[model samples]
Target: MNVDPAVPLACEPANQNAGTALQDPEQGALSADEYALFASVARVRRVYAGETLFHRGDLGTTMYVIAKGAIELDFGEDLIAKSLGPCEFFGELGLLIGDHARSADARAIDDGELLELRHEEFQRLVEIDPTLVSYFLRRAIMRVVFNEQSLIRRLRRRNQDLQSALDSLRATTQQLSRTEALVRRDELTGLYNRRGLLQHLRERHRNGATSGLGLLLIDCDQFKRINDEHGHLIGDRVLQGVANILRSVAGTNDIACRLGGDEFCLLVKAETREEVMRYAEFVIHTSHGLLQMPQLPPLICPMSIGACLVCAEGEWNDWYARADTALYRAKRQGGNRVEWQDNAPIPA
Candidate 1:
């Protein structure tokens, strides 16, 4: 095609006209000199608004130059789509690239004329102008540099986003752990409360590892009398004092709970009869401070304990009832003592 250098390089309403600035190297419209040199190989085509010119994954045999209106090239993989206006040429990479596959989808945003250049045509044009090889080489190097920089930016952003998500997840997990601990503990005595007691007992029983596990149910004998005589404040201090004593005497593997009111429970790991008796005696001996009435005058802190061995064959409630029965016997036979479900009694 003989393009007259004097004629303006512009597209007509229906199609592109030959002889334009696209072939003029002096014009800055083409980013590279190679585009102006090889663009002469292209033929004109007409496109309308909302018309699809090309798609990603299609065999890219030809490149397009927009002489009029606008065209959008959407990289199918990313939201970073680009819009090209007049005097801009696209798919010019056909001259330097060999894979010949479209990298993005190209659609017309408005009615316009385009110049389509095929790879074969570009090769023939290169033979006509031997310097075309040098221009194409320069453009290829520039494309490589631009693409590498773009990929690096995307990777850095992705890494930052991943780190942010992990940090949020870690914070959420820690908060849940704190909330769970608070829910299972008593606010007043800092011991496991009733809800904590039930959950622990149920889990222990379900595990079928109740061998050597023993239960000690404790109650503050004549507690109501102390609260009535010394006010609830003194009564609460007495309860906390008893809890401290039990906590101190209990083994590291054992669990202690306050079952509301003046009732408490201790689950111990004493394997033999002697071990169990030792725990019971130690609790009674150390709790003498509670029995002393600082303000109420000798009528305070007296407690009764019911002991029973935990059995895997029995349910949590059954073990509790047996221990409770032992407690009932200790209370019935006068308080301030321990009664074993096996009929053994601990000296107060």
Candidate 2:
């Protein structure tokens, strides 16, 4: 199992300076007496070129001694490889440490003959020639030390790679969090957008508490006239003023959203139809007061709100449709008013 320590033992091109670090290269081959002793009890195994004897991490129970041709031991990525020629032995760890896992892949570099030695065969050989067995055992211990040093080097390299991977993951996570925040909000009003409303609806539905909720669909009456008479800037100011009013009245469990353009909606927690009607009236009154403030541009844009209590058996489309119907009715009666729908539509 032990080879001269000075030589770089690895699987590389044949042109590379590699082999046992013995002072005399001939010493790498077994002596006639050593070969005779092993050949007596060893089983001959023939392997063709490119044949795989075992893979890294496989449980190894037998050792192989090369008799002719060559074998290559490949220690995967960032480690040295070893190529064994005639008379050199490998896989002694399987015999030394019972049930040992192979640290490298063993494959045939050429059509070769190897002497396979199992634990029992090795034990019987030890009893017949104790002196020779002790000599090999001493070498085996040195081989284990050499392999331990190699493992320490491999672990150090792995630790560096792990830290780099962790840093990249943290950066990616931060970017995703920022993107999610931007996606769920309106840039102008800083209110939850349509996408955010859908997300909130999904969460509420998941909790199975769809009842006792109210939806108010508010629209800016004659919004196009406001933009044309004054300026688009003044029109924007009116929408912002309305958004501020909705934000002030919303409870902790409520969501206020800009459903695009001059349309906004509020989803609030309410116990009865009266409570929902009161909330809509509060929004309409507050919105009028805020827009008429002396500091703001002098423009009149009345808000018409359609209010309804959400039904447990219906979805958002059903809830919005009923609110929308009530909204049109309010606009028809008067520009600045709130209309409540006592009953929500039944799903078909």
lDDT of 2 at 345: 51
Task: Give lDDT tens digits, candidate 1, residues 26-72.
Answer: 22134344445544665667789999987875766566667667898
Q: How accurate locally, in lDDT, is each candidate?
A: 0.67, 0.75
Mind sharing the TM-score for model 1?
0.51
**Where does candidate 1 clash, by residue pair?**
9-20
**Candidate 2 residue spans exceeding 4 A from truth:** 1-160, 344-348
Model 2 local distance difference test score: 0.75
lDDT (Cα, tens digit) per residue for candidate 2, span 160-258: 533443354445445545555566788788889998898789888999978899999999988888788788989888788778888989999999999
Tell me the spans in candidate 1 whose CA falls farther than 4 Å from its real position. 1-156, 289-300, 343-348
- Candidate 1, residue 338: Cα displacement in angstroms equals 0.5
Compare the candidates by TM-score and give the number of the best one: 2
Model 2, position 214, has a per-residue lDDT of 94
Reference-based lDDT, residue 20, model 1: 48
